[model samples]
Target: MSEQSPLDLAEGDPFGPHNLPYGVFSTPDAPEHRRVGVRIGDHVLDAGAAAHALGSPYAALLARPTLNPLLAAGRTAWRDVRRALTAWVTVPAHRPDIEPLLHPLDTVTLHLPYEVSDYVDFYASEHHATNVGRIFRPDGDALTPNWKHLPIGYHGRSGTIVVSGTDVARPQGQRKAPTDPAPVFGPSVKLDIEAEVGFVVGTPSALGSPVDLASFEDHVFGLFLLNDWSARDIQAWEYVPLGPFLGKSFATSVSAWVTPLEALTAARVAPPERDFPLLPYLDDADAEVPGGFDIRIAVALNGQVVAEPPFAGMYWTAAQQLAHMTVNGASLRTGDVYGSGTVSGPERDQRGSFLELTWNGTEPMELPTGKRTFLEDGDVVTMTAWAPGPDGVRVGLGEVTGRIVES
Candidate 1:
């Protein structure tokens, strides 16, 4: 029998030809020489090298250390490059030249794929918002009066964004208890994680022009798993008049692999029904493409499964969020990222954050590792997810993980 080729991926492999997520990597032999790579099964294809070997026109875009150039190329180029990549891997004639450029996945080190220009995170899940409100304002309405009208978001610190496997130091800030007459300074005792899906912008929009809901696909390049680490104590004390600050600005983690939006065609679904009429700019009643995605997220703490948040149940869609974001004429730039905030479902096991899962520590969770209310030093949090793909296959979003260390 002949030796099986690395390109000959087994059936139903999430990283098959149908799903060629991109990343940046460097081999141990040349640690500083990073190049763009595509995940295919168990191997990473040296995208730039393969493009040069196959005499592909996209060599200029692929032969780079980061994904920003390709992202700035706009939607048409993105489609063309994806088509060419699909052919390069699926077509037998190109296999000989492409085979040699393939590298074992374990032999390379993955890095942050792009230089993020800006970061914004949205509170778009109704279930999550309601739970948070109920926990904090027990006697008041769970849903805020303005919650249904627009996607509430806050600008986040882009400098703290890190790639998967990075360790995060516990942040120190001010916190106050009802019994205390004043606030105290110390490391966060209520460390938590918010499971989210993030969208990466590919094209830039003018500073004065608003991007409508219909232009979402034209600007977004891909999607990935994100962990918006939070310090509940710090946030509760600081986020009074304004939104999240030091608690959220400390660190955020993202997956190395960015799955192209085109590969998620089958995952499109209708978002949860709205209870109130939306404004003209944020409305999607007559939109051609469905706004919701059927991506299922699994969040684990210390290697044990704790929550499974459903992305499809989100109240606001990415398109609406983009439209709302740019409605004020805020310019879009390549490498800009926005997160679909804590994706929780109606069930208890579906809550995406420790705040909701443990009811703000009023209840403790029983795990094999012992009882827990919030993250502890040395605790590792990991998130992984998959979306429906074409022909019954699955499109996997790369996992994002981080370990908490002492401040």
Candidate 2:
């Protein structure tokens, strides 16, 4: 009897044909020659090789070492390529040529799929923002006056974004306490993780032209899991007048795979109701499609699940974020990425960051490993998520994990 094909995945595999997320990978035999790859079951299909073997017109786009080419091809091309890819792996007649291009995922090295252009992270979760405010300013309102009016965000360092599995060296910076007269310099004693979902920009927008809410899908390619590593001590000291700098810039980890935006059709839901009237540019009350996604995220420390933040509860949506981000006429580039800042729900167990989970270290969570408030030097934090897919299938967003190392 012939052996079963690796392509024949078990029923309901998350990374099956419906969820063929893209990435960049290299084999041990040709480590330097990186190629664009697609995930299917436990294998990575060399997209460029498969395209070439099948005489696909997108061969040039997929043939590149990075995702930039395909990303720049815009929405139409993205759809066409995705359709072709789905057919390539699912249609049996093409299986003979495609099978040779598949490599065991474990045998390959995954790299940062795209060269990040600009990085921006937004405080879009009302629950997370409120929790943070209550923790920091007990006397004042839990949210800023501008919180509900628009999406609050800040520019981040793109150079520091690393692919999952990379070790995050503890950042050294100035930190101060309420009792300290002067700040002290040292490695962060309160390193934390911000569980986030990141959107990758595909087509570029013209400079000085604003991208409205309706146009979000035209320019964005996909979404992925992101861990915005933070140094809470450093942030507390420096984030008063300005915003997150050294505390957040040191490193941000992203999943190796990028789940295409199209695959998440079934995940769309209406965002939390707005408390204040939105500006015409920021309004989405009548958007043909709801902006929120139902991506359920799990934050795990040392392989133990600590929290499950629901993306559906976020007040601001990626569409609104994109509309707000480019509303200033700041042009969008092909590889620009923006994060849906720490997703948290109304419940405590749904909190997405160590800061809120531990209530700013005042409450230590008991885990099998030990009591933990903030991340230790050897702590490993992994975040994984899935969204509702067509026919009740679950679309996996993959995981982003990183170990904290001493500075």
lDDT of 1: 0.95
Backbone clashes counted, model 1: 0
Local distance difference test values of all predictions, in order: 0.95, 0.95
Candidates' TM-scores? 0.99, 0.99
Task: Supply every candidate's count of residue pairs whose N, Cα or C atoms clash at under 3 angstroms.
Answer: 0, 0
lDDT of 2 at 140: 100
The positional error of residue 323 in candidate 1, measured at the CA in angstroms, is: 0.4
Give the per-residue lDDT of model 1 (tens digit) for 377-397: 999999999999999999988
